[model samples]
Target: MLCLRSRTQDAWLQRAIGATRDILVDHAHCERKAATQALMLLGRFPDVTALVEPLLDLAREELEHFELVLALLQRRGWTMESLAPSGYQAQLHALCRKAMPGKLVDLLLVAALIEARSCERFKLLAEHHPDAELRDAFGGLLAAEARHHAVFVRLAGRFDDAEAVRVRLDDLASAEVAILESMPPLSRIHA
Candidate 1:
């Protein structure tokens, strides 16, 4: 099993099922951001064997997911709106370490945590959502997100001490959950 230390709340899932248009819009932003992050990592560590090919593939898949989500929003007559700031991401990012190879390890751990949270949230929606279509759609994404999370975890091992990565991951994940608790109980993909 994945070693993520956080799980989304039940109330959050209930809120998300009702506000799918908003969630889809946020999901699109998430996909775009994921792709951008992957590319940025690629640029920063172009020669890291563990990151190069996987990050490239992640970028491609995330971009595709963005397009798919945007299309879904359009089909629902919901125009892609201006992006909003994500307190969740902001808080998690603030926890990243600021040193060399350590910085890279932190980044990978953060990515893994985010993907793990996404997978958890999607799994919740798949099981509890009232709409069959929404359930099916999110269910389809569960495997992909799980794989992304796993890949990031595996990549973090390229560091001097994978144990240290896990320690920081646990710390950041605890921080992330605290941040989530402070957020509004709204229907959002990341909420």
Candidate 2:
């Protein structure tokens, strides 16, 4: 019985590690996407050059993180796989309006929420995972995600009408919750 329990625990840990790896890959992809999106937005709104520089720096950092995650995967003899489309992102994208100011505000709020959730999940995984290396990686990722969240929040604040932003954030949060709750079992974010 002891041996069986030990095997079970080991299996669980392995699965957790695999899940974490996949999440890291997905996160790297998100960073790349965000960087590109920010650049495009900056180009469209040239007047926001000051706001764009920070985002450009963030993109570069995210790409570097992607490289790190790729190296880690290679070291572990794990091949990165294509991830299924995430409902969380889709839900956020849906909130973005077609117009200028509204579009920018919505994007910032959605980005902030995504970063916030990523930070929260990284903390949870770091605490719960059995592997020391993975735990440490998650810990570092948690800090980065927190910083990313702060950046988005700061960017969002630059816009006019604090109350309007707050209301939109609330709406996005509600939609995010629904997306998480409604996802199928294959979605590991529910874990």
Candidate 3:
């Protein structure tokens, strides 16, 4: 299961469905950000050979998801544009450790939590959203999001013991739940 401490409320799904265009656009931005985050990890830990191939593969897959979202938007005759961030990521990331291997572990765990959340939300959309197109699109994405969550958590374990990583992940997952509660729901993927 995903390490999330709370389930997204029905209210959030209603808001997302009400703003489908914005949600799709925000999802596109989220995919781009996920790919960037994977690359950023690679840059930050160039000497960590174990991370190279997996992170590269993740980044590639994220970009592919980004393209898929873009195509979905295009098919709807909608054009992509910038949207204000929901600020969820900044709040979650602010809790990361400032130091070395700890930083690496925290970063990986945070990414896992993010992907876990996305997978959860995508499942809701895939199952409950009224639009068949959106439902099918989200269903297509569900497995990859789950896989990414596993990848990040597994990579985090490479830097620390299982128990230590679990504790940190639990702490971070609690923080992530708090971050979501503190924010008003929006169409953005993390809002």
Candidate 2 achieves a global lDDT of 0.67
Q: Which tens-of-lDDT digit does each residue in 42-158 have in candidate 3?
A: 998899999999999999999999999999999999989998777898888899999988999999999999999999999999999899988999999999999999999999999
Decide which is better by TM-score, 2 or 3.
3
- Which residue pairs in candidate 2 collide? none
> Model 3's lDDT to the true fold?
0.93
- Which residue runs does candidate 1 get wrong by more than 4 Å? none
**Clash totals for all candidate models:** 0, 0, 0
Runs in model 2 lying further than 4 Å from the true structure: 1-18, 187-191
lDDT of 1 by residue, 1-191 (tens): 66656667667876887788888888888889999999989888877877888898998988888888787788778988876686788777777778978888888888888888888888998899887876787898889899999898888877858678778778877876788778887567776
Question: Given candidate 1, what's the lDDT at residue 78?
Answer: 92
Model 1: number of backbone collisions: 0
Q: Please give the RMSD of candidate 1 to the true structure.
A: 1.5
Model 2, range 1-191, lDDT digits (tens) per residue? 00000111233334545676675566556666666766776777778866777788777877776777677677777766787676667776887887877888888778877767666666766887777876787787777768877787678768748788777777877777666656654424322
C-alpha RMSD of each candidate structure in angstroms: 1.5, 7.9, 0.8
Q: Using Cα atoms with residue i matched to residue i, what is each candidate's TM-score against the true structure? A: 0.93, 0.81, 0.98
